[model samples]
Target: MQNRPDLAVGRVRHQLKFRLAQVKRVQPLTPHLVRVTLSGDDLHDFESASFDDHIKVFFPQPGADKPAMPSAGPNGPVFADDQPRPIARDFTPRRYNREAGELDIEFALHEAGPAATWAAQAQVGQYLGIGGPRGSFTIPTGFDWHLLIGDETALPAIARRLEELPPGTRVATLIEVEDPSARIDFATQTDLYAEWRYRSESDFPGGALLLALREMYLPTGEGYVWAAGEATIMRAVRQHLCTERGVDKTRIRAASYWKRGVEAVHESIDD
Candidate 1:
């Protein structure tokens, strides 16, 4: 493990730095999960304190050798008219070490797009640009228990939260993935009950994640729930937690990472 940044000293930082990172190593964690480690000199001042903090990754065009990065101005990023806009995708910061100037970003190899394509062919020494988280949703530690539910896209965030949690903290995690081989070991000391649900290729279009949540016995007491993944499926899970399980709306944080068959989409609970 590397030294963490002083990011969480107080509240979340609205002002952040954007840096160009070079790919140091890429390891295939599972059949559908790849862990990419990036390091750069400019990343020394980076800050990401929240569990679900996002970093925008810029990808080069199909035939281009490098991505055109947007310059930062007083307000925000400044783009040039002559240069082609780089394709960008939002991803969670799985791990970061200020001492080493390295950040681990996990990619779920479930979709096909510029980001996916880039991850599939990512090589050492390749550069990828990253930007601010803008803000973070830091969960309070006072909850009796924690419930983390999502698909592969939410795994990085889930793992971050699990590792950050204090020892003896109780947690129940529901993860829907391609198969059992897609499972990842939790390195945290928290009392975690992890459930990995597999989806059959022949199965009809349905919400397997929601079904798994409905069948499980939710832990008792005041708990905080974080759910992310397919939009409609997440909607159903949020509804179930509130209407059926009597979970408080304010205690649950839900976000739609993407929609089935929809291109480049994300919707948060507040959206």
Candidate 2:
């Protein structure tokens, strides 16, 4: 298992040294999905913590020049003195290849956020600045079972988790999406029970996922529950997991991938 590195403690220090990366390739994976591969000389030092850890992307406007990516601390990368920096957005690192000095990020082109718009039109050789591996969180695979819940924005992280899991591991996944055709397959050799919750065009977040979760049957055992989606929806899931299902606080992870009526946000849970 690649010796798992001295990850627990040294991970934070490694993250603090956020190096600036440059965009290298961009392609559409699906009609609503864009895959962007970034690379830079600084990537030689990029250390990955886990699948779900995220980085910030600084995107340039159509007419404007590229923006300077923010540094981890007060003194980091300096922007060009002449051009004003473009808007930046937070996104998850879908894949990282330090040997090849490349990192891949997938974006869902649903909304017109700065990040989404940039990704939809991204091209090879175009330069965008990147910073941070931030931090990582993972539930111990030794658990009796695991539950994964999320929407499209959370798919990359969820997919990463499924891929990294061990064989014979038991997991339950409930993914909510606008269409059933958006479903992506997972090949976890584990005892996995996955369900897809489709939210029709007439429906919105927190509607179908909540009802499906409420009506679904959960196996009885000690399990870790991880969920990410719209802020309010995830909060509801968290509340149910803690109060209704009687799961321990530490065993459950709920994050808001995006909020309704908001734009260009990446942080899970605002308040």
Candidate 3:
């Protein structure tokens, strides 16, 4: 089976060109999910280190009527030198096509974030700004096994990781979504031990991911783990893996992709 059905193998390692582009909204994945497909000349050169790498997306000011992008300063692009800068949010690159020079960014449309709001009502020809992927991250395809876990917020990155692994690679993936319909098909020839969990509550606070991990006894092997979602949940999972399960800190790439009760731009999780 192919490594990534969406991206060509050679394009996987190429540096992606960075530039501002217009946003196009595809059919909403769910009541709260919007898939935004962005295209621009600059995308021809956008670089990504791995499927999990993210780019910074800039949205217009609160009252702006048109899709005005940030200005390129003498040193580089400048975002509102005075007062406050426009909204900037991080989004994973779900797919990039060097040939078409387009990118697919899936946005979760929540009530209060700039990127989310823009995505929900984005119109054709509406321009938005973007920044470097800078680099991408992936473990060499040499490990004996792999473990991936995260919530809906982490699904894009997790699916991308699954696609990038070589055929026959052993992988275990656990994903938590709001409902069963939110579950998307991830086709791969890799030996994927996949599971999905449903959270009945609407955005309630709980370390469901950590709970899932703690209940399972994983296959004993030298493997790497990647997880992302709520910062608090990631912290608990990372602590458990590194300290209790004897997984090396170096082998885990865990991050708080988002935090509960915080705005996207101001969200932070301890390193």
Candidate 4:
């Protein structure tokens, strides 16, 4: 059989660096989502090859003007012994313009967290620190069809993926949000089927995303499933797709964007 690039997954590693950036603009995209655009000369060489790529964002400590960034060590980031470690969280790179030296990261204000708190009060010209995406996990868009699922925290990645898909691609998105106001318009040229589930309507721990997934009919063809959100919810989604839906494990990608009551949890779910 001929090699199928549509089924191929690519990984790319990037040079790691800690860059200090200033908040260029802060725009509220929805009632629960805010988009913060950061810009600096340090971002001129930044790269993010995947929609789900994450970067470590360091927030300034109370009474501090800028965050205390770690040095890039041989093994990884190294912090000074005397300085207070910066509060950091993994955030998806929503958009990046190398020519303009700007990066857009959307912050979900569903819960009170250091990142969310900082983003809500962010002001133009305020300094923040950002670390590398480190690497990228690029999924092939040439698949016959695609299924994307996630909650509020995964909106940036889901939106990016939808925008990147080429014309004629078939994609279905199941998104969970706090309420109807949280829904936002997505611009895409693909054959799209998008649904929004609301937590206000259901007492389900993670909203009605998984239930909707189970009841919906998937498109016919070889397809890839991508999901990210609360850890437990994502685990169940992955299990359902693999065991009940009969999708190959290799054709599904799931990530835990956050865990209830846990801080700074970002992990891939395999198995």
Candidate 5:
């Protein structure tokens, strides 16, 4: 009899650097999602090893032609006190093509934020600054199946994971969007079972997603669960999975991409 391979998660650190890039193209993937492609010589060596890896995008201050770039400091990045600081937001590197010197980032237009506003009107030749992914958490694909859960903000990462999975891999996804218009197709070689939940007037962020997860059927055998969305909901998800579903804590990864009434929130739920 053959033995199943052991599943292990790995982490890799990256050198931090900021690069300047220009908007090469902008396309609307769905009603609430806009994809902006940036190109630059600096992206030649850019690395995004994990599907959920994030890059800090810097936006120009109001009425400014370009963003104020930051310099490396002992503690972290240092901004000039004399100059207006640029607005920065965290976004997943949806796609990156090294030879073509291009990187794709998708923005969720559900809310009014600096990044979303910039992406909504992003035009070719417009310049934007991007910083490091800093690190990557590599999850082994040798598990029996994978469960992915998230909302519109986590779409890019979920889509990237679906695309990267090996053939015959089993993955079940639960995605929450604004409405039917926000739904889109995913291209993958894996055995995919995707379910979409639409939000209503009374629903809170991740409300529909959590309801679906509670009733969804999990695949048999050892599997990994990856989820990201609102902060409060993610914490509940981790608890339910560990307590109700009896899933091992180490076999699950949950992240809070955003929080209610909070700006620039991105964190992992590991408690």
Candidate 6:
């Protein structure tokens, strides 16, 4: 439990650094979602104030037991020339308790890759490395309502917003899951009206989430929207919001967590 697993702990600066942590516990949220709790003294200063903030999870190489920690370079991350680059993937921070030193990250057991493979078999005392989330996009809370849309991969971020948003904020959620069994409940104080669309019941061309968005009614007044999941569908959703619904581009945030039919970033690294 080194203060800084990959670099010396800073005495003054608070820049994000690589942290070495071990799995303390795991919880199966659903048949296809697992929550892995990573903890260590190195997380005492972990900062993830924004609901949609992400962290880079580093996994052990092919046959290694633990991930190789990267050192902070003058301008970027630096690794040894001979060392195999550990598999890394972006994951949202579901929860972070600095006082108790704990970080919870959820994995969508959808794709087969080093990150998902590691999370699926993660057990107590298993080492993992995390870094960055160097910045946060703290959305303004003045919106009259909020619209959230996504799939299993977006759950971590969706859940975070629900838990942290103002209790009185009105939120409309449209989530598409693998099946009915994948639907989940949340503990939050936001004024939420949620709708679930099962992929098993969806017709292609637009998929469940986009179709749901098409049929549902968005709340009135100035509103904010956040959507994530398959890249293609996300693009369509964003387009619809901008062109069809007239939602201001600045007030909507859409991201592609992964692309359908393509190997995840970890499995198909580009040269």
Across 1-271, the per-residue lDDT of candidate 5 in tens digits comes to: 1234458788898888888899999999987999999998989999999997999999988887677888766666888999777799999999999889999999998557898889888899988899888889999888889999888888999999999999989999988888889987998999999999888732576677788888989877889999998899889889989999888888899999998788899889987
Q: Is candidate 2 or candidate 4 better by lDDT?
A: 4
The 10 consecutive residues of candidate 3 with the worst lDDT sum are 1-10
Give the TM-score of each candidate.
0.91, 0.85, 0.83, 0.97, 0.95, 0.90
Kindly report which residue stretches of model 4 are placed more than 4 angstroms away from their true locations once superposed.
Answer: 1-5
Cα displacement (angstroms), candidate 4, residue 268, comes to 0.9
- Candidate 2, 35-90: lDDT as tens digits: 78889887777766766577767776667565555445555545556766657676
Over the stretch 69-145, how does candidate 6's per-residue lDDT look in tens digits?
78878676888889877778889999998877999999999657777787788799988999877767667655778
Best-to-worst lDDT order: 4, 5, 1, 6, 2, 3
Scored by TM-score, the top model is: 4
CA-lDDT, candidates in order: 0.82, 0.73, 0.72, 0.90, 0.88, 0.80
Model 2's TM-score against the true structure: 0.85
Writing each residue's lDDT as its tens digit, candidate 1 over 132-222 gives 8777878776567889999888999999999999998989999888878898998898989988787763264225666778898877766
Error of 1 at 17 (Å): 2.5
State which candidate, 3 or 4, has the greater lDDT. Answer: 4
Name the regions of candidate 5 deviating beyond 4 angstroms: 1-6
Better of 3 and 4 by TM-score: 4
lDDT string, candidate 3, 1-271, tens digits? 1243332222233333337787654657677566678887767676666877887787867776533445645555555555576677889988887887888887766667677777888777777777767556556665677899887777777777888888999999977777787787786778998877777643454445556788867777667787887777778888888888888766677887888788763233334
**How much lDDT does candidate 6 score?**
0.80
Local distance difference test, candidate 5: 0.88
lDDT of 4 by residue, 59-168 (tens): 99999999999999988999999998889999999999988899999999965888888888889999999999999998999888999999988999999999999997
Residue 211 of model 4 has an lDDT of 81
Ranking by TM-score: 4, 5, 1, 6, 2, 3
lDDT of 3 at 136: 62
**Which residue pairs in model 1 clash with each other?**
none
